[model samples]
Target: MTSPALTKDAIRAKALELGFDAVGFAPATLDPKHGERLHAYLDDGRHGTMAWMESRAEQRISPDALWPDARTVIVLGTNYGPRTDPTAIHALKDRAAISVYAQGKDYHDVVKKRLKALGRWMVEELACQIKVFVDTAPVMEKPLAQMAGIGWQGKHTNVVSREFGSWLFLGEVFTTLDLEPDRAEVDHCGTCTACLDACPTGAITPYQMDARKCISYLTIEHKGTLDPDLMAAMGNHVYGCDDCLAACPWTKFTKLHTEPNFLPRVELTAPRLADLAALDDTEFRQVFAGSPIKRTRRNPMVRNVLIAIGNSKARRLKEVAEALSEDLNESVRETARWALQRLEKP
Candidate 1:
């Protein structure tokens, strides 16, 4: 086995060679403060309909608890910044705005594949035992990345890197290898409330977030009917909302992602709400292949499209909303009916 000291630098060099934008190391430990805050968020019913967040509380906050044998965590970041302003779609009110992250291939798949390859290299080259984790695992990746000096978790609850801004996807390799830990990055969000103020649903509150009111959570994770007030306030954001992310001044450092897989699909970049609202199950599956939108299934997506159509200033979408009134998905049909009613009013 290679000496622990020598392996740390080797691992980092290999990570960069593997196409990861940033990599750092941290000792596996529990984040008690984050745990308490998460508990409070759940206790206050702030997670909305995301019951799974409460169910996995223990695993979410502690790395040692996730895998007791984990000694070192190698955190990796992949940049997915867009080439243009994500909010530009708002000018075309008849279109739906999908978050930049979901505008390309799913990060979980893309990041995980790279992580697994790195894990294999560690085993063969360093003779280390390791486990790879993306969002699929119970790892608190943002906090781990912060501890590894990749970046600090800004008040918006996302990691902010100097080079990549807040436009990176994080993954981890929890290994039994005793690697040197990196210096933790300091928080640079002093007195800045731009992200908090920009949130359309007011989800951000300093270091905390009321996930119930987050448009991303409401539109994607919250499975049932959303409150009419929240739906109305969502504007044209049909999938996930990026106001908090886009509002970060740190993003000024961001450059367009080099990964071809992350480039925005022509159809998804600014898809018309009329076309999206018209997707049946088969059409939805076909349109969203390899995209993160497939995760929500046709029902939620179409429902969101109807909500966007309702909020659209374009009078042309009235017919689009009317056509969706008979959608096969009851949720889609219901939201379409509501949209048509709102659009038809004088």
Candidate 2:
């Protein structure tokens, strides 16, 4: 086993060498205020349909609650910044606008594989016990990342890196080794309301968010027909919304990511809503193979596509929405009806 004094630097160097854009260390504990905010959010039903978040509330409050033996957390950030503006697709009402994060191969697979590699190295070299997590676990990654000094949580409630902007994919390595913690990052948002103002559905209010009103949550996590007002506010976002992230001024410092795994696929960049509406279950699975969008599955995907079609004023997509009026899923069928009704209006 290596000396305890050398572990922190060694781990940081190894993580950077392994393609992580940013790395930081934080203790296993969390501030009381974070827990209080989480409880308040949950009590207010801000998490919406995500019941799992509530199930693991205590564990998510502090890393120690999840693993008492964990002495420190190693946070990793991978930059997936886009070459083009993510919000630009909103202008092309006939095209489907998938979120920038979902435009490539699934980030969970990419970030987790790298995290496992780092965990294995720590176990082999430093003889430390470790567990790795991507988004699947009950970890509070954003707050932990902020505490580790990788970035601050912006007013939009997503991490904003000074160097990588709003484009980081986060994962964590919890270890028994007690490494020195990095100074926590201070909030740099400073009176900037760009993210809040960019929200189409008024889901964001400074640092807090109502997931029920968020387009990203509505299109992905939501399991039923959406409110007509929210559907109209969603614009052409068929998968996830990037309006708040794109509006952040910090993004100006980020360069396009060169990672092959994160580069946007041509088909997802700006697909025709008509083409997306025509994707049957098998075709939906095939097109989104190895993508995060596949997790949303065909039913909800079709439902979201139908909503986008409704918001699109293009007369050409009217028939596309009509064909799905009797879709097997009630949400899809309802959204299709809404789309037909919307398209019929002048």
Candidate 3:
């Protein structure tokens, strides 16, 4: 068993060899007071229908509360920085704008596999007990990542690395081994309002975001019909929105991810919205097989497509929306109806 006194550089080097862009260590006992803002964000309904966040609020606030035996958190970062500007697709009225994060494989699967591999190495080399977690875990990863010196949390609430910009995906390994902690990263956002100014939905304000107004949440997390305000703000995004992330000036320093799995598929980079709108249940399944898009389910994807179709203000999409006006999913039908009203009938 490697001693708790193992040098931080050794472990970080191991993680970097594993293709992680950055790595840092922190004590598992993160301050509970650190989560007061999370409680406030949830209490204010800023999280929208992501009620599970509130349900796990207590555990999310205290990592020791989540895993009492855990004494160290090994925060690891993988840069998924896009090779191209993701926001450029928004101007393509006939295409669907998929968030860069989802343009490739499901990150949940890709990241979890790496976490497991790293955890196994820790168990074998350090002879330590460990637990691995990715985005789905109740753990609050962003703050912990900052505490580990991986990056600072941006105003948009996504972790931003000066090296990777807003394109880093975080995962953590909680270990029974007591390791030295890194100096926490501080807010480098300064007076810049690039993310705030670029947000079409005005979801970003200083250091907080209203998830109800976040297109990412509305399109991917919110299940039911979005209000007119949200619908109008969504523009042509069908899966998730990256306006705030793309607007970060730090992006200029980004080194494109070398991970083959994180690269965008040729067809998905900017798919024709009309083609996605035409998908039926079977075809939707076939199209998004093993992809993260299935998390929102086929109906919701279609629903988002309808909203984008409406927002495109394209006369050709009128028929596309019309075909979906009587969809089995009531919300999809409702959104299609709303879309129809936006298009010129003649």
Per-residue CA lDDT of candidate 1, range 84-188, in tens? 987778788887899999988888899999999999998888777899999867788888888999999999998988887889899999999777789989898
Pairs of colliding residues, candidate 1: none
TM-score of 1: 0.96
* Candidate number with the higher lDDT (1 or 3): 3
Instruction: Assess each prediction's global lDDT (C-alpha) against the native.
Output: 0.86, 0.91, 0.87
User: How do the residues 1-346 of candidate 2 rate in per-residue lDDT, one tens digit apiece?
Assistant: 3665577889999999999989999999998888999999999999999999999999999999999999999999999999998888988989899999998899999998899999999899888899999978988899999999999999999999999999999999999999888999999999899999999999999889999999999988989888999998888888989999999999999868889998889999999888888888899899999999998988898888888888888878888888999888898899999999999999
TM-score of 3: 0.97
Global fold similarity of model 2 (TM-score) = 0.98
> Sorted by TM-score, highest first, which candidate order results?
2, 3, 1
> Residue 206's C-alpha lDDT in candidate 1?
90
Clashes of 3: 0
Q: At residue 327, what lDDT does model 3 achieve?
A: 91
C-alpha displacement of 13 in model 2, angstroms?
0.9
- Tens-digit per-residue lDDT, 1-346, candidate 3: 3455564666777788888889988889877666888888887988988889988888898678899999999999988988888888988988999998888899888888888888888788877899999988889888898999988988888898878898888899999988888999999999889999999988888888898898898889999898988798889999888899999998898989888887788778989888998898899988887779877788999999998998887997789999999999999999999999988644
Best by lDDT: 2
Better of 2 and 3 by TM-score: 2
